[model samples]
Target: MSDNQNLLAGQRRALILDEVRRRGGVRVSELTRMLRVSDMTVRRDLDALARQGMLEKVHGGAVPVPEGRTHEPGFEAKSALETSAKYAIARAAAGFAAPGGAVALSGGTTTYAVAQQLVEVAELTVVTNSVRVADVFHTAPRPAEGGPARPATVVLTGGVRTPSDALVGPVADAAIAALHFDVLFLGVHGLSEGAGLSTPNLAEAETNRHFIRSARRVVLVADHTKWGVTGLSSFAALEQVDVLVTDSGLEPEARRVLAERVPELIIADAEEE
Candidate 1:
């Protein structure tokens, strides 16, 4: 190819990466039209990017690569670490639920907080992979005297359990695939600009991704400590996130970046009683 052609290809590829970063993923067809290039050329660009470990080529698009190392702590351990923040975040997220709504909760301490607050919501169908979360509704009653018990039904996924109390694998996937949710209250091991929403265990990541797709809206409940850490597998990115409810502990600069990427970012005041 001539110098100009080479320069144009490089520029187009750069633009594609930029688009993916901003929107989480970019389709081959969209890139072709945006670049004024042929479909074959767009695929070649994606192929090149994929080869460099910059992105992963999916069915018709590419997503960013996960950055940094990530690990998971047991459920009880994490629950003790961020008691107030999780409570605050959970309260904020629980407010989103409506009566008779189907809400899915992925296994995480923050989400367990959400589940705790959710007991006030009457008749909500709660699907979860965590035994602890499911137990919240086992015997919940409204605050009123002899008030009616929360008619909420908790569906626990059938799968192998993790130390974090998350059930994952084929059984969980199949169960999640058959159900749909009005909103998904998700918990992640970490969130960074590069890695997006990630988890330490590969199976949990897969289960989380399935939950993400099963819901119409994704509401993330996380604390600031999740900002820098990364996980082994990333299930979604800012583009995929519809709402993020985090704690005030997040750094200023991280909030700025998240605001730019996520459509709705709510930094819950964990300190407020």
Candidate 2:
């Protein structure tokens, strides 16, 4: 490559890494616009980073490498949706967890809420791939203040980080495969009868699959808004989910479908709580 070409390539790679760290991931279209480069140039840059293992390239974007734990969505953005519903779901989910049970909490807003509820529970072991979820347990107070002793153990999966600050990909999958959990609670970007549970990233989907396989039971936690929407990747089929926990706002037809498809469907009315 010529001097100018080499410089441009380096600049593009740097910008890609920066965007992944800032946003957790960056779509090719966004990178092309930000770098003022063609689609092909952006793809080339992503490929280079993938080769170096700086990031994991997916269908439309790239995920950050696991290193600094600071990468994740801002509190405001993540806390914007289904706040009440998430809490209710968290409450219901926590009820199913025994005092010393091992649980895998996947990354997502709803799962984050579940982690918060777990603060009051004693002797629970939580394995997660979310930086934000891990922080919840790490900062929880001791039982003297009427809280549980945080949690017995918190395991963070290592891998590429998504814009949502989720750790995913091969490293995360490997970690999940090595352990078995009594229950696994997952949060999805979308839920559909035809599409099942879905996420916006392929690497995350793979990581979720491993989580499902490693768990004795899989519980899906999603607000009503997730129903009917289709994301970029399909993680698990509805049949694979042992329980479906959703908000009361879900339509009657949706409830019927979930009841028929999954073994158990729990709807929590946030307004009632």
Question: Which predicted model would earn the best TM-score?
Answer: 1
Q: Score each candidate by Cα lDDT.
A: 0.83, 0.82
Candidate 1 per-residue lDDT, tens place, 123-240, comes to: 8999999888887877665457676547457899999999889899999999999999999999989899998988879998889989998999999988887897778888898789
C-alpha lDDT of residue 126 in model 2: 94
What's every prediction's RMSD, in angstroms? 17.7, 12.3
Candidate 1 lDDT score relative to the true structure: 0.83
lDDT: which candidate is best?
1
Off by over 4 Å in 1: 1-70, 142-149
The residue-by-residue lDDT of candidate 2 on 1-273, one tens digit each, is 223344446555765676786588889998766766679988887887777656889889889766322233333344544567889988888777778889999988899998898877779999999998998998887667654455789999999878787899899999999999999989888889999988768898899999999999998899897898777788899999998889898999999999999999999999999
lDDT of 1 at 139: 60
TM-score of each model, in listed order:
0.72, 0.71
